[model samples]
Target: MSARSEPNEPGARAPQSRTGGGGAGARKDPGWWGAPPAGKGGGGAGVPEQKAAGDPRTPKRLPPGGQRGGPPWMGAAMPAEKSMNFGPSARRLLGRLRPHRLQLVTIITLGVSSVAAAVVGPKILGRATDIIFTGVIGHQLPAGSTLDQAVAGARAAGNDNLADMLARMDVVPGVGIDFDALGRVLLLALGLYLAASLLSWWQGWLLNGVVQRTVLRLRADVEDKLNRLPLPYFDRQPRGELLSRVTNDIDNISQTLSQTLSQLLTSVLTVVGVLAMMFWISPVLALVALVAVPLSVIVTRLIAKRSQRRFIAQWRHTGELNGQIEEAYTGHELVKVFGRQREVEAAFAAKNEELFQASFGAQFISGIIMPAMMFVGNLSYVAIAVVGGLRVASGTMSLGDVQAFIQYSRQFTQPLTQVASMANLLQSGVASAERVFAVLDAEEQTPDRVASARVDGRVEFEHVSFRYKPDKPLIDDLSLVAEPGHTVAIVGPTGAGKTTLVNLIMRFYELDAGRITLDRQDISTMTRTELRGRIGMVLQDTWLFGGTIRDNIAYGRPGAGEEEILAAARATFVDRFVRSLPDGYDTVINEEGSNVSAGEKQLITIARAFLAEPSLLILDEATSSVDTRTEVLLQRAMAALRSDRTSFVIAHRLSTIRDADLILMMEHGRIVEQGTHEELLAAGGAYHDLYHSQFTAAASVDAEPEPAAR
Candidate 1:
């Protein structure tokens, strides 16, 4: 029963032209690959210009400071460079943290409390210093000498500066050092310092959790968005670049938040608290320190503006470089087979250089802020010290007050420096957020209908019109029908729309004009899950995930049992070879499935389709990889499979589809002929020419003379 009489010899395949566009190798719509127009989230401000036209080998140009556009595989449509949305993206990034507002407010409160306590500690310690100085001066004076008398004695001794200094010092005439008061002040300062440290630590711990949770939600949203995107969107994007957005870009955002959030809050609060203390202690010195504020702001603004652009370039180049690396690694065998290793290496080097330059520019520019801030801070420090000394000498300020004011000045400048550094992280994080947001904003597939209907294996395409572009019509008014339990065979040359037809039936895309129905129920009325649920498909390219063979087979039917899996495998002859292997069905297949032969891989797919028990079946060049003997067995199994289900088979080989109930000959997305095999040959039409051409070309190749033995 497995050996039916073979029909005419199979046809020799024509050479296929390679193209970068089209889905399933069925169309030649070149416009689909064109670069997206400007202002559509595509190319804009900072992108590098394209290389020479029509030369895929030519490398793209680099922008000033070495930023390269995306790799060619991204089709020039992926956003290489554009106007930055720093303010908007940063706001949106903060919006992602809205759900954790309570935690954030708590963290801010703790930051304020901690900074306030630390700010007071310096003043308390300064008071202790004042107490010790006064005790020393008071101990040296005569027991009954008043402050006026002490000043007179100093003036009489011709030490005018000492008299002026003594006038500023508040010394009781006979009192020595107050160890008790100094100890109390020191203990109070220590307690304040300890409390500030504890509060800051607690705030940091809470901020870490809040930031991690926010990032977790962001990552989840991106994952969901990716799933909702249309197939055409994926076709337009490079896999490596998209992965970078999902993984690398999100990771960068997380790092930025973790490094910046708590520190920025604490620094800002510290600045406010210290500035208040500075003014209270000495308005004159506080005003002097304020002089540096304007200078610091101007320097930070100028550098951050330039570095923001660089950060955007840095992350974009990172994504593009990742894309190129992925493409090279994925096709390494092809590169080796064609001996294009040098070319691949050259492309990688070019992109790596771009990344290096971008990273260098961003880091170098942002790094300048820290040193500039330090210089400004030092200038302010000198001004504050000189003014404080004069105030103390004039008796307008106590020595302790001047000392406290000096400490406040340093505290103030340090936080300003911290804020400036945090700007670097903020810019980098926002740039990454913009990239992640772009994915979330992509156009999604049409929403599925809430209502659904069960399928009965009757499929009809009615007045269907569709195209990948506005001017390029791939399928125009195409119509077909297949009755229940019938085997429909579709044969065509490359780009003749054989695969597109099947894809249409699966609703991988929507029709532009008419409708497709299953058992008289409009397919568009059903949810995609419900519509695709009852259909089983096997394509020419076998896809096996990294799992055991048994698991792969079970993928077709999620809850399929051991008995069902075994029966399906046995029916397709998969069990015969699988049992011969040492581990049998438990043998693990690697990600690429290189451990299995092409023919064996094809059989496993057939077995998977068998296990699905679908009401509708599609096989696109399903038996092309198997040997003649194995092909015969698969045809027999396919026949039994189609006995009670509607089946659509797309094939190049004529011999395998001889027994089909109906044969459709398609060209240019239209069916040119349709009939039974014998009927078509009798008519001597397009089908006859196609059938005989295969037999004749194969026969001629077999008849060629072999080289004679010497």
Candidate 2:
């Protein structure tokens, strides 16, 4: 589904806010619209001030040149990026061809045949040279052309040998020409080129089919790998960075296969075939050309090795810039609030400049290979011409052989330049392939065997210890139990590990120690499908995909009928505002339901949860964003839904969870107190202090006049 956005086109007026019944239609600013770029800091208070790349300490900062840097977002707590082994990664990429062995074998067969046919061109052209030469040798009569003039001049100078050499013709008075041999040689050369071209076309057609199939499987594997990987893997890496690996990296590999792979095969064949023809024609000339071969190799190797780093840097900068765009564009509103638009743009420009420099260095450095190869080739050509001319003067070599040797030399040297360019492309392709393989080889979550008996709403966390990282243990040796059909409200200050506890219950993160069981079964023992199927979560974010309201509501149970969906909506109080809209339940929601108010989107999520009717319900700050009046309505609706299920509520607004059956007052990573609201208020502990602090603060804010700026 396409993301719905308001028209910011030129001349378009800004949208007006609807201030209607119960003030529910009043416009509200969405605090943050997107996740931050994933990096080491985890989007905490300070983002390490966006350092430049190259400095290792600043994990996600762009250093001065923006050559290469870590993921900019700290939203995902992904593991630190690791360097890859090129050889193994390339081997793994080649192994993908194992599945399409037949097609590959055919393409290679066609390539070999095409090259063999192509090789005949230089040799056959040389044969045509011999024919033309023999036709002209030792016979003179056709006098008008340069060769005729040369012979006339030689005869005038009284040089019989020079005259015979210049006029090497064997035409009889009546028969005149040996057109038969000349025609056959030229026609044969044309036929060979035509055949070679046709064979290459067939090979390319087959190779394209093979490339598409291989890339298709590679893309599928990357997608499947995402599902198998643990949530932690996604935490520290930006989605954009991973997207670059799956799409841009894989696409690079496919392109190389289509372009470089065939060129590589043809270059090797052309080089070998040309050398054979050269040696057959003249060994001494062949030796002169061979000397340039090593020079070309050394020059190409030196430049390619240096260029490889720049190519890697080019891709690295690309991933970083992609992450920057995603974060900045998606979270445009947050940047506006902070007034960091200029800063964001500056960071982007710096990263873009780095990417440009890296690409320039990679391309410019490798680009020199062709010119360098051509220079060496020309030197060899000069040496061959000089040596062949000397041999011809000594009567040891014919003009035709010398001419053929020069042609063969050009063919041999041409592929070396082609090979040089392909080598550079191959290096870039291999770098991309390694990134793709890195994603494929990432650690996967252990497979679960679903025990298909039954699960009650009873949940128990026994001495469970867990942490995002070893340095800071978020939850430690915690024990809790919620019997079937009970309301467990977890109340705490921000960063009190409230959401972390919810994550543990849902098994989104594995426990560091101990066990969490549902009924008598360990939650980890069941497949995530079976376990999560019974649990319903409505986070504060209230995410909504781009679709009709009906589609979004029915996402809880995709095949649910209209009546059931409407019933769920009515039960959750979503039907109240939904009916006020002209389109009713069919009203289109934008990405994240931006078209609707925050409270409205929240109610829709409640309706979805109502439809699911899960055995366990988790609400993490489900009502924190709503007004006091709307909160009352939602609380009433939630009470009805919680009638026959075990529900866990994490709330910052103490008033909302006041009536919860049991309130666990938490601080740090443990529950400091647990009781009913009234019981806690009477006890005068952390819960009492927190309840007073929230209400007292609200009361003071209401009484105060205009406040001064911080």
Candidate 3:
């Protein structure tokens, strides 16, 4: 079959060349949306007129300049544009969270309270320590007082007497009393610790409810969109990739929103509170702690730059790996029959290895941020201790203040590191969001007119043409008609657009050029649901969803009565096989009918179609994979079902199409000849050639006398 030229329509164009050798530009052609420049002579005949000559309305192409190919710091294979802006995704995600604003506010409040309790707990303990060691131990009060009395007196005395006594060598209160203010300090620390723990637990509970519910809703919406999306959208995307977006990508988002959000809040609050307390205690020490900020920031920035790229790579490779594994498993039989196990394994292994490398690199880079921050934190702590100790000794700062400053320094560093770690999780979440949004933002299929009503199964194709890609036209200006209550069998060589013809009839794809009508109404103008409701199709590849036999039979006609399902099954001869099984109608089918034989799957599908009771029935190689006995049974069943309904059948077995009212022979996307079986045989054209190719050998064998009764 010769490839047809891209129809020079207003929007037809070869995709633009990629910008760089690899990375984003290599992965996706930047000019994918740009239309090709129109050629001379208004494009050859059969082309749409608007695109025939260069339309003045088309935008002029800009010359490439500045960071168009690759970044200066990156290798030639990595494009500068590989770094996607997160602004749009962030806005979209944040918008989704608006509905749960109250939940988010509560979560953040709990997180901040938790950080406050954690921070203040140590300060309360330090105060109690100073009261016990200085006020109670210095003997400024009576020597032999009870523990409670001593603690009360020490609390009343305050820090002045202690400082005076230490300066003048005078005695302070409660020197001989045991269990002084230290007990109070311990109690206060315990209370704060408990408060922190409780707040954290509550935060987790609330965040979990919000995140889980949100994710569930989001995933459900995505699934709903999948159902509504045009069937042609699926043709260009892998099932595995789509599955990952729904499952893995959404899960990643949940993790990010739930955990990272809490961490982010806690870290920011802790850092702010700690820095304020540190400056109040000792500005010198606070400065020392603040120095670590720039270093930490630099390290985090570098790691984030590298990690983001790695994350993108990881997700891409993961999608590829999933696609390969899914393809291999789905086509296992074909692989085995062709002895391609080793080749398939090699391809899978290669994709898996790529995924592993990308994942490792991404994780390794992100993993460095925490330890790098910690190193800087440790240095800052040492500097704070040295500077504060000297200041206290030189009488510029009090010992209690110096101690508080040291505690605050640690607090500040802790949160900074925590925030850094949380950033990694946030980035990963953003990466997943990018993928999910890509699906959400894809162009929806054009909607048809709403005025078109239900049809009575009369269909006509007028100069219809279609191409999956601009460079490959599978159907070319093909025209045909199917009247009500007529069986039109389509006979064609492989790749002769047989299946595509049925797809058009179903309006799964929009025609590139031409009009298809049903009962004098354009199919495009009809609602997809209403259009498909009147039609039933049994594909060569039968798919059975996970359910019981009865459930599958009544799938298309939910709420159907048991008698109706049974009658439909009987009509397709599925009842006989189903009855042989232990559970009869209760027999279960796995995904895609993996547990059933091909003939049984086909029969079940036929039963499903029969139950739907459509006005138009399409059988695409319905009995191609069945044995002779099964084929004969199916043939009879199909013949019985065809009466008084418009039907389209695509078949290779000559015996199946013998009684068809009209037969159209197709070759290379065009109808070469058309007539009854007898007329085609008499014409000795393409149809005759195909029939003879199959039946000629059988006829010769029959005429050879069957090996003389051996």
Scored against the true structure, residue 556 in model 2 reaches a CA lDDT of 84
- Candidate 1 off by > 4 Å: 1-78, 140-144, 158-161, 702-710
lDDT of 1 by residue, 1-710 (tens): 00100111111111111111000000011110011000111111132211110101111233465343333332223455866888999999989999998998999998888888888988997899899888988999989989989999999999887788888787888889999999999999888888887887889889899999999999999988976776556545655567677777787787778767776787778778888888888777888999999999999999999988988888888777766765555556777787777766776787678877887788788878878998999999998889888877777887788888877887888777777766767787898899999999998989887666666789999999877666877778888899999989998777777776776677766789899889988888788777778888876767666689999899889999999999999999999899998999999987567888999998998899899888999988899999999999998998888888999998888888888989999878789999899999999999999999998998999999998999
TM-score of candidate 2 to 2 decimals: 0.83
Question: Worst ten-residue run, lDDT, model 3?
Answer: 25-34
Q: After superposition, how far is residue 568 of candidate 3 from its true place, in Å?
A: 0.9
Candidate 3 regions off by >4 Å? 1-83, 135-182, 334-339, 448-452, 591-595, 697-710
Residue 621 C-alpha lDDT in model 2: 81
Candidate 3, residues 1-710, lDDT tens digits: the string is: 00111122112111111110011100101110011111111101121111011101111121245322211211111112235466677678767877789998998888778877877765676565456545544555566655455445544677544333344322244463235556867787888878887887788788779878888888888877766677556544554555566666776677677655555566677777777777776676777788999999999999988888787776666555554555455556777787777767766676678877887777778878878888998899889888876765454765656676667777777767766766566676787788887778777878766855756778899998898777977778888888988899988877777777787777767889999999988888888878888888886656566679898889868799999999999988899889899888998886546667888987988899889888888888888867898889888888878887899998878778999989989877889998899999999988888998897888878888545554
lDDT for 241 in candidate 3 is 57
- For candidate 2, lDDT tens digit of each residue in 1-710? 00011111001111111110000000111111010101111111111111111101111434456543323432222234345456776788888888888888898788778777777676677667766665555234443445567667778998866666545543332233367988998888888878887887788788778878989998998888977887656554665566666666676677667666666666677677778877887888888889999999999999888887877776676666655665565567777787777777777787679877987787778777868887998998899999988876554677777877777777677777777766556666787887787788888887887763466788888998877778876678889888899999998877677777777777667888999999978988888878887888887755676688888889887689999999999988889898899999889986535789988888888889889888889887888667789888888989988888999998877878888888998777888999899999999999999999987988999999987889
Q: Which one wins by TM-score: 1 or 2? A: 1
RMSD of each: 10.8, 12.0, 13.8
Q: How far out, in Å, is residue 523 in model 2? A: 1.2
Candidate order by TM-score, decreasing, is: 1, 2, 3
Candidates' lDDT values, in order? 0.76, 0.70, 0.68
- TM-score for all predictions? 0.87, 0.83, 0.81
